[model samples]
Target chain A: MAELTTLREAIAGLVHDGDTVALEGFTHLIPTAAGHEIVRQGRRDLTLVRMTPDLVYDQLLGMGVARKLVFSWGGNPGVGSLHRFRDAVERGWPAPLEIEEHSHAGMANRYVAGASNLPFAVLRGYVGTDLASVTPTIRPITCPFTGEELMAVPALRPDVTVVHAQQADRAGNVALWGITGIQKEAVLAARRAIVTVEEVVDAFAPRPFQVVLPGIAIDAVAVVPRGAHPSYAHGYYDRDNAFYTAWDPISRDRDAYRAWMQRHVLDVDDFAGHLASLAAVA
Target chain B: MTAWDTDEVMTIVAARELRDGAVCFVGIGLPSEAANLARATHAPRCVLVYESGTIGAKPEVLPLSIGDGVLADHADAVVSVPEIFNYWLQAGRIDVGFLGAAQIDRHANINTTVVGSYAEPKVRLPGAGGAPEIAASAGEVVVVLRHTTRALVDRLDFVTSVGHGTGAGARDALGYPGRGPVAVITDLGVLRPDPATRELTLVAVHPGATADQARAATGWPLRVADDLAVTSSPTGEELAVLRDLRARTAASRGGPTRPVRPTGR
Candidate 1:
């Protein structure tokens, strides 16, 4: 397995053009910096999938890096700005995005099923509703054992999955101590996985049993402290409202957003410089 | 206090008696915040059911709405609205159905489907999602609404879900297994049913409210509970969190635009 040797080179190396990429984090618990880096670096036609996208999706969508997006829900908390998305829906953009609306369980279950290398997994979720409204790519067949009809959510084997972890070791094994059920499944379902950590540990054993993502599933680790800035790490930090508001996808002016991007992201290629610029602005 | 202050009181009044593990079929705004607070503090195991299929949602932040990823992303399991209603809720699982109202009557009846006549009337609401099924099948209903004479009318433009209509043991006679609409919680006070005629009776009042004030807000002969309790005001902590969530939610959609408030339908 090719290990991530350096932070700057790792992200650039792992992520490729025209690949289906699924990102980790949501809303305020965003993978802000790395996501901005990916977007500003101009990764194009890269199908981006987030459980429920917000600013990251908007920034990328607005910038035209993402060609297609598959998600359950889009738009920010209250004043969700899926306007670029709206315009894409109303007046087709780069490549009119395809929206797949369903519950989070249904969205992740497909990945879970894929990760386990199972033919299909039976779930009693979304049995009766408009969730069946979104025409799925796969069709269902009757279960012989119970005679109950089972839905077949297609396998989600993304080309690459980028996740933000709370901590990681030198050998690439990761540990995420926050709300995590989707992460385990996501890391496995993808062909390649990149784990960004808040700190790097050297053969350091985790004191808490719950803190781990065994070495086998992980391939590359990038140690970037305060990695989950906008995204809180369980009880570590409260949501940075100033940071969130600064990147307010719903209300931010185009020019201001462009400037924010230029100064914080485009102007710098590395995390340190990005942090420095962010500090300079702050 | 001001009218919005009254609304906040009404919101808390409904949340007062929440028990653990209740499958609260929630909508957005006040209901969502109340549901989350009840879960976070009072009822740890409170299974917050949403229309978007999230059940037992433990969101890090107060979800902006039912469809907020925080709802399902952190939920125990997500079920379809039909299954949420048909199997879990209507199949007799939900403990208490917490709901807000645009209008109420002395009979504890609610109107959310339409404002005027069914076919051609005044306003059209977001439409009946799972409210009909929930009202019909939940263990019991606990309604939260601001008490205004116009809101607490003698008659409804439409019967969204039969809470307690004009008769005694009517819902029981109709074969509703669950005890329906035990109380109507409002900014003014809490109202229960009179055992004899199933008419609504004032059961509790807020800190500053009086029985006469609650009576004035109703259009019919409002019955009185034997010993009514006064609902405490939102504490500083409660206000801080609720207000923070409210402010965030309000400012979320590009800072507040004029809200469409007519839902007597």
Candidate 2:
């Protein structure tokens, strides 16, 4: 059975320095509160992984917690570039960051391979593209039956995988809905998994199109309400479009980004405190 | 019929390029607008697929990102991300791959990754999501970008997506199943690949745009078709539907807050 614990305890016990951590979400249900707790713990040298490294990953990159990034795409979504990411890569401001990039297809199949306990996955991608030249992990393979060529990428098994979901029952079964990206595969592909949920209920009402992770599969479940703020939690709240728009300016400058993180992430004790501080300022 | 912005004219041109019942792999920004416009106006049966695993998504509002919930809300099916690429895209099920690029070269190669060297210096644009596969696997790829010398360059600083490679047969050598980029639509006009050279050539100019102006805007020594023609102006109904769509998109939650235009010029 999964242990029910606080966010800080969950991070402290499960995640460690130099672990390859994957926080999976499509464009919603981002485990931002978990990211904040990781920052608050001051964990360092992590290999951060995601399909699209949005604002949460940007915060991790800015805080000098990440040493490497294995991702397909990194951006501010509706906004422009991630300035902290740029600074790390372009100028090595916080630290010299290493990047191993792939296409969305490539990364997703890698996770699928890991979930299946396969050595690698095959797909017809990266052909005639520059990515193959840059990322050595992508290689060519031939079909034994037809002699056709395909691209192959190794499986991605992270040390820890964290995600945010809508509900978790008292039995520790987690339920997620709406735009479920690779959360399931990501969880199964990791050594340890943590799920932060909007609420802990007594029993789950099964619904169509909902993915339920069995209690045995998860290591820990933490109740962090509004955990996916900035990013939405599907039916619970609307995406903070105003904050996304506001981030472009705040994250554009180095000093501004550092100051904002200091106040919002580092100085705050927990997610609730972070929310309270935000409310007080607003 | 009515005064249309350059962006509107570009959208109409892009929409006309789509065939009815074509399965188009779409990206965000202008490609989404063009594909949605094609569905609303000319190509009503066009199937819109997003990389977020939403297939046949007919959103009432423009999706802010590929992963916006509105896409999944009305999608015919929402599969996992791997299945969308391997089974649908790489299997050659997509008839058209519509994309937007930050930088494009004479060979139609696109760069959405970086502006300078790989390790350092200059701007860091959004890296490729599904474009590399979309360009290589789709039966045909179409690009929409702003018309500027900087955008239409002689050589891209980095090639994020493969088009015709350097010339004809270049992409084939790499075992790409698709034919690569066939057309490029810009604010000024349309560019098609030359049959023999595979170099992008000016085929048609939008109204109020001149051949000389188009040539001057290209970074390379551009070649114009001997019988270049003027694009037919947007019809009144077309403009009305396109405008209405934009208005609705701006009003929709999780949609563009401002007027939709091409980014990454």
Candidate 3:
């Protein structure tokens, strides 16, 4: 059974230095609060993994919390570059970050393979692309029956997987809707899983396209309303697009990046405090 | 008629490529706008599949990102990311893969990865998201980007997605499923692959753009069709719908009326 806990406690209990951690949310339901907590707790050398390493990973990368990133794409979504990520890769500002890249299909399948407890997943991908040449995990395999050649990627089994959701029942069953992305596979693929939800509800009414992660699969359920903040939580709030655009300038300069992190993420006691600080500034 | 910029004409031309009821797997930025414009204008039944797993997404306003709540809220179905890639894309259920790239070569090969070396870089672009598989697996592919010497290069710094590989028979030899890039639409005009050589050739230029300008903009030894057609200007209705879409998107994002140009990934 999953324990109901605070975001800080969940991060402290689940994440560790040098762990392979996945904070999975495609473009919505991103675990921003959990990522912030990981930054606050001062974890180091984590192999931070996500399909799209959005603002949260940019923060973690800027703080030197990750020594490596295993992802498909690292960008500010509709915005341009994740400046901190670019800095880390280009100049090694905070650290010389190593990256193991894959295409979205490859990454998603890796998670699916991991969730299925399979050794590797096969797909008709990377046939003529440079990805197969660079990524060590991608290799060619021949189909025994049809004699067709395909690509195989090793399963991604993270040490901890963290996600943000809309609600968690009293029984710690997490229910999320609206672009659930790869959260379920990420959670199932990890040795430990943490879910930060907008609220703890009595029971799930079960919305369309809803995914419910039973308490048995989760390690902890943290109630942090609006945990996805800059990223939206479907019905809870809209995506803060201005903040995403605002991040560009703040992350471009090292000093501004540091100052922003110090003020918004590090100095705050928790996510609520972080929200309060932003509100005060606004 | 209302005046339309090159970017506007480029979007209109790209939107016109999609057939009614065609399933287009949309990349963010230009391709998204074009696909949405097609749905809003001529091809109302055109299905938009976003990488975020929103299949057949019909958004009222342009989405700031692929996984915006509007996409999911209006989608026919929302599947897991793995399923979207595996069951839909890799399974060849998609009819078209509409993409934009930082760099494209003579063969329509793309580079959204890096500017210099992979080991040590000048600029580290966002690596391949779904472009590789989309470029490989869709029935056909459509590329949309601004026409510049920097983008329409002789050779890519890195081949993030293979269009026709080296040239004709390359995709076939490599056993790629898709029919590579059928059209490379840009601000200047449209370049379709040469049926024999599979090299992208300038088939049409926009009204104000000349073949010489297109040639000057491309890094390679550009090829032009024998009877290169000058594209028609954007119709009033097309411009109105596109501008309205942009205005609504900008308003929702709390920005200026014009949608910002996407910086290369």
> Across the candidates, what are chain A's individual TM-scores?
0.86, 0.98, 0.99
Q: Which model, 2 or 3, shows the larger TM-score?
A: 3
Evaluated with DockQ, which candidate comes out highest?
3
RMSD of each: 9.2, 1.9, 1.1
> Which residue runs does candidate 1 get wrong by more than 4 Å?
A26-29, A78-84, A90-95, A138-141, A203-211, A249-252, B1-6, B20-29, B36-265
Which of the two, 1 or 3, has more lDDT? 3
Cα lDDT tens digits, model 1, B1-265, are 2234776666555666577777777655556657776775668788887655567877766554345545655677755333454467656877877766667777766665445654343543333334544565678887776678878888877665567655687676445656768887776888887878778888788888999998887877677777877777767655565566566655653454311232211
Best by TM-score: 3
Mind giving the per-residue lDDT tens digits that candidate 1 earns over A124-190?
A: 3333232343446434557889876655677778888877766677666777653443566777888
Task: List the candidate numbers ranked by DockQ, top first.
Answer: 3, 2, 1
lDDT of 3 by residue, A126-215 (tens): 887887888899999999999999999999999999999999999999999989899999999999999999999898996899999999
Q: Rank candidates by lDDT, best first.
A: 3, 2, 1
Say which prediction, candidate 1 or candidate 2, comes out ahead on TM-score.
Answer: 2
Q: lDDT of candidate 1 vs native? A: 0.63
| lDDT tens readout by residue for model 2, B82-195 | 778878998889999999888899889998888888767487777888898898899999999888998898888888888889898898788888888899999899999998
How many collisions per candidate?
A: 7, 0, 0
